[model samples]
Target chain A: MESFTIVSGTAAAIPLPNIDTDVIMPKQFLKGIDRSGLGEGAFHDLRFDAGGRERPDFILNRPGWRDAAFLVVGPNFGCGSSREHAVWGLKQRGVRALLGTSFAGIFFDNCARNGLLALTLDPATADALMEVAAGPEPARLTVDLTGCSIATADGRRWSFTIDAGRREALLHGRDHIATTLTRTGAIADFEAGHRMRTPWLP
Target chain B: MPSPEPLFPHAPDRQGPRTLYDKLLDAHTVCSLDGEERLLYVDLHVMNEYTSPQAFTGLREAGRRPWRPSAQLAVVDHVNPTAPQRTEDVADESAAGQIRYLRRNCADFGIELIDLMDPRQGIEHVVVPDLGLAQPGMTILCGDSHTTTYGAFGALGYGIGTSEVEHVLATQTVVHRRLAPMRVILDGIAGDGVGAKDLIMAVIASLGADGAAGHAVEFAGAAIRALGMEGRMTVCNMAVECGARVALIAPDAITADYVRSRPRAPSGADWERATALWARFHSDEDAHFLREVRFDAAAVRPLVTWGTSPDQAVAVDGTVPDPGTEIDPTRRRAMVRALEYMGLAPGTPVRDIAIDHAFIGSCTNARIEDLRAVAGVAKGRRVAPGVRGMIVPGSGAVRRQAEAEGIDRVLIAAGFEWRQPGCSMCLAMNDDVLPDGARCASSTNRNFEGRQGRGARTHLMSPALVAASAIAGRLCDPRDLP
Candidate 1:
């Protein structure tokens, strides 16, 4: 995983609330066994029409926002499905973070583990940033995880809060599996005690 | 979505009356790490074809094997066909490749798999509980969000992502952050025509989509205790639609009886010991909760979603909602979009909404009891002209049992297709997809955009309501039949 410290780029605004994983990465894209080339499949239905032609009206397909690194999304974004493919496709398409008022439980965890910053903001503050991102001129924003704040080119800033553990892991690019493996002795000891108490467990 | 400050923060000493969620976390804890995050042992980890291929690939790339192969189980459901006749060969090459990769990886790691040809094969959530793999006082995890279904049996179960899947495969434990507890009390008996699906749908509609976010919800009270295992499973399964990470029901005689009757359950002395331990898995009378909500079950009616999200639902007798009445700007716009997508006019009766398809199957409501309910509504009734109705059982066991009870014949005679077991038309990963612009009355969990197919519209209801709607060629409540 890539460490996420600070990033600055164009921010696209998708203000539709509850844009679920099915919409982010449709079922057709999930057939792939590996994680490569998923950028084309990210938001396939929204970005392209039935004939596979790009829809000119979509924000991500418009000029100046085609390569947005941040998404200013609506409340309860990514609210369905536990498919990590949604996160992978977003990262592949060059999105490094999502700013929303709230997010679904599973999708938020997926973003944390995969190094995509899923920031939760108060509704008023999120709405303010959303306005800037959706403006006619292409909006540019900078996210500084070290300072826990998001800033625009005009020097306006909004501070965010994140779980201390998740913030530490994102800053260091930690591998959770490797970290858990080092506690093998503690796990085995716990298992021994647990099994003795409930002998019927498989 | 964070819970309100708890009365007992951490409860480190394990003193005082504790919630079922707190007890489960303490029983499974391996070690306390960072604040609120601990290494918790997973007694069972379920996997399906779609979300797990990448995890297995990651494990191989790292040259690591499963720490405890026996703790995991895999099945093929999401990307398989559900035609009348079952076959080992998948039609789509990419889907077939995924199944093949899963088979190879499970074999390499020494984990057990319920393969396509196995009679026990079904949706992971459906099959695991049917086989008695989900028991009280157990901590279960799966790569699919519906793993909350196992909490129907008093188990501590929730969903995880593929990265967590890799971690669980390499180590039989995953990090956990304790969720604030919420108890949903259901009082009074639900009248005729009201079922578990309707009750849950009503709850979701009232609470909104993210109502239970960041909370571990437990269903309790008189009406909940009266429901059988299948009803309980239906309620717990859709709790995820309301953003609950875990949904639990305390263990009782019904749970004990169901677990004991399963093939894989312990017998005789071992059973006695197991039941004794499970008796203590419920919350103490004075257990603390961050929140509590009560509902009158008698007020519930058969529910059908009018919009893309599960929360945008109303009773079967209700009319379409006008976005102009909504106060929130974002929510009002969402309602307008949903109404346009559904092709429904404001104030129109839901019964006037005609459907092209009626699907009766999913992990949510495809058990034997559910099929029996559908059969009761379909027997001696004919499906309306131009309506295509189908019933895919949850597992082979459920299909066979329904067949022996002559439920299949009744449904088939009524013009409904009796198909093989898989998650058909639920997520539409298989060939059982609805065409563009087609409307469906489905007994499934989600009503998201393009859930059944691109440009397809879905109205989610119970199995009985689905059958009643199929016969009427519209969204009709079961009580309105004949």
Candidate 2:
């Protein structure tokens, strides 16, 4: 995991609401055992066409997004399937943060473990951010987790929300697994206590 | 600056009665990080080949072993071909490689695995409960959304992502947030042809998708209590489609009877004690619910999803709804896209729409009871000409039961392909897939864009409706036939 305090970069946009995990990384790309090198397959169905050629009109396929480091998506993004390939695909493609009005519960949790910033903003701010990022000139969007706010190159700012635990982990470059490891003693004590109550449970 | 008000004013934190969800989380909390966040111990962890490989790889990369190997179990389902015998034969090369990888990983990690050749091998959702692994008052998880299926037994089980999967493998727990609770109460008995599938479909359609976001839903009322374990499973299995984190039913005599004498279930005095403990796991009278919706089960009819989302549904005999009927802009846009993709018109009667395929099987509705209902409709009849129909059992045990009663024979004589036990066509991860531009009536859970296959259009319905649709060569109601 990498520290994710702040980042300012060009933002790509996917305006489809309820854009589920199946669309993010389709079933066809889940065949391999390794999770690496899957960015090429990200958004396969929407990114490609019947002839296996890239669709020219996809938001990510445009010239302004070639260097995109962030994504502004619609509500309920990553709504289906529990595949981490969706997060892995975006992270591999260099999108460090996602700005959305809302996100699926599991997808939002997955972002925390991978050090990918997931910010939930009010609908007005989200719309404003997307409008600025989807511009012809490719406005640079700045997301500062430490400051708990997002801003565009033109100086419009909006405060967002993130829980203290997730904020602490992202700032310190730690994942939940590492945090749990640090609490090994407590976990062991809890397991021992649990076993005493239901010795029959497997 | 301070917040305007408490996020959940009536929650147990304010001395109010706690929800069933609260009890489950509190019982499993190993340690708390902050308000509403904790490392909750996982009692049972189920896995499948499609999602577990990378989790195992990550565990190996970090030089870690599962915190509790005995608490973990793995199965091969997503890519498993439903072809008969298949004892150990996986048809596709890539699928076989993944299956082999699962076997190797399970053996290395010392976790119990239901392999492809095992008689108990099936969808994780069905296998866990059939083997008595999912029980009351437990916290379960899997890397599959239908993991909500376990909630039928009064357990708390939900889907987790691969990253969370890896986290649970190494720690035997997951970092979780306290969730708001909602109760859906069904009061009256359903109509003659309506079933649990219809009831759940009606609930989702009424609320719209994303209606229960960030909440755990408790299903109650006389109608829910009257349903058998199989029917209860059908309802809980689709809870995720409503954006609910999990779905639960309070334990009762029916639940105790269902868990009485299975492989992993307790025996003798242990059974009596376990049941008594589970009996106390229900919500108290003073419990608080963020939102409550009541339904008259007698009013529900056989329903089908006409569009991509499960919430985009209508009665089986009704007409497709116009996108303009939706007030929310996002919902209107989604409906428009769904209609265009499905090649349907706003006023088109659902019964007049023809389909290319009729599939009756999935983690959502593949229990033996589902098979019996489908067989009851298809017996002594033939599938309409040019319509391909198939029945894939949920588990090997379920298939054997269906065969002992000659359900397979009835289906075969009715022109339906009697396939083996696996998650065939529920997801098009293997050989069972729809061709481009094909329309299918599926018994699976989700009906998202290209879910069945690339360029495929899916109509979600109950097994009975699928049978009737196959027999008529169109999407029709069961009551319309026979």
Candidate 3:
């Protein structure tokens, strides 16, 4: 995980809504959990045809979008399954940020946990960003987490919202477990009392 | 898409009055951070192959063992080939590797591994609780979102990501954040043909897919209390489908009875002590819900989903919705897209739609009670021509129990394939899958696009609904059948 303050990259768009995690990375590709080498499996069906050939029409396969640093997707993005392989795939594929109207809460958390930024914007603003992505040349937008704003190549800027805790976590590249460990004493105290009341629980 | 309904509509918002979730979370809290998040102590951790391999590997990299091997359980499901005859022949080499990895890793770590052929092996969600590993007033974590399934026993369980998985494996605890509690009260008695599936589907229909996001819903009232343990499990299983991470039903006699016979359950004096503690697990009378929604169980009918989202459902006899009637533009577009994907015409009776496959199994609705419902409908009937029907049990134990009760014979005689239990065709991770353009009536929880197979369509319904529809080779209401 890298401390994310401001990131600049060309954006690609997968305009389909309700893009579930299964679609992002199918169950077949989830066989291993190491998180490496999963980019090949991201969007497996949509990215590949029955013959295992790349679909020329896929946004990721299209020229100019080959190295997408960010994704401009539709609403309810990453909607199904708690599979974090979706995040691993996107991160491994070099996607640093996800710009969407909204996201499945679990998917959003998974992104933040892995040092990938997930920012929510109103559809209209996302539409503005998509326009920049679809412009004559591939567009690169500079997203500043500290400033909570996205600046397009065309000089237009749209603000976004992120909680303070998440912004700090992303900026510091903090693993959630480390933060949770700070309160181990409190956790132990509660567990000791809980064990007394229900002596049979393992 | 957050629903327009206010979450705190039940009463004026207040502070200091703890909810069921708050109480449970506070009880398990390690330390509160900024009053917004807290570290949580997880009692039970369950894992499946698809999402857990990375965490186990991470443990090996760090030279760490699971904090408490006795507290963690692993099961090989998801990609398991369900055909009892072909259990040894895994067609997909990669999926076979996944199952093998899970077995090898579980052994290396000293955790309980219920392997594919293990009679105890089944869907992790179903088998863990079935064995009484999930108990009341405990906080449970799993790599699968449907971990909320154990909330039926009054557990504070929810899904977790793989990173959280490695964290829990190393340190027995994870972080918890702000969560609001909502209660869905089922009032009045359900009419004939209406079951737990219908009740849950109706709730989703009322609250949209994201309606329960960021909240925990507690099912209560007479209708919920009246349901058997199996029915309660069915309702809680789909709680995640509505965007809820957690669902609960306070422990009662039914829950106690269900746990009593399981192999891991406490006995005699221990049981008495456990029951006494469970009785105190309810929310304080003064507790305030962030939201409260009520559904009259009597108004529910055998239900079916017609669109990609679970909320896109209606009564069995209802009609496909016209997108024009949806006031929200985004919702209207979603509806139009769903109708197009489903190849359904608006205003067409849902009962008239046809299905190519009828699948009866998933952790959601694959219990013995559900099998009995399928048997009840298929006893003297054959699957309609052109329709393929299959029933996969949730676990090998369930399959054996069904066979012992002769339930498998009734289904097999009625043209339904009877097979060992695993999550078959639910997410289509194995050999049993629908082809592109095929339409299926399923007893699974999700109906998201491409959920069953690439370009395949899924319609969510109860096991009984799936059985009746299979007999008719299309979507037909059981009430309309003999």
**TM-score per candidate, chains pooled:** 0.98, 0.96, 0.93
Residue ranges of candidate 1 with Cα displaced over 4 Å: B1-12
**Recovered native contacts, candidate 2:** 0.59
Report the lDDT tens digits of candidate 1 across residue range A1-202: 8789999999999998889999999888888889977888889999998778999999999999999999999888898899899999999999999999999999999999999999999887798899999979898999999999999999999999999999999999999898899999998898887777777777
| TM-score of each candidate's B chain against the true B chain | 0.97, 0.96, 0.95
Q: What's model 2's TM-score? A: 0.96
Candidate 2: residue B426 Cα off by (Å): 1.0
- Residue B129, candidate 3: Cα error in Å is 2.0
RMSD of each: 3.7, 4.4, 5.2
User: What DockQ does each listed candidate score?
Assistant: 0.83, 0.68, 0.57
**TM-score order of candidates, top first:** 1, 2, 3
C-alpha lDDT (0 to 100) for residue B347 of candidate 1: 100
Which runs of model 2 end up more than 4 angstroms from their true locations? B1-16
lDDT of 2 by residue, B367-461 (tens): 99999999999988889999999888999889899999999999999999988778889888888988889999988888888888888999999
Give the true-structure RMSD of model 3: 5.2
> Candidate 2 deviates by what RMSD?
4.4
lDDT of 2 by residue, A1-202 (tens): 8789889899987776888888888888888888877798788888899689989888788887866888898888888788888888888888899888888888888888788898888899888887887777778888898999888887888888888878998999886787789989988988887766566689
lDDT by residue (A1-202, candidate 3, tens digit) is 6779999999998776677888899766766546667898888888888678999988888888988999998787887799999999998898999998878777877888899999889878998887778756788899999899999877889898887888989999986765665666765666676667567887
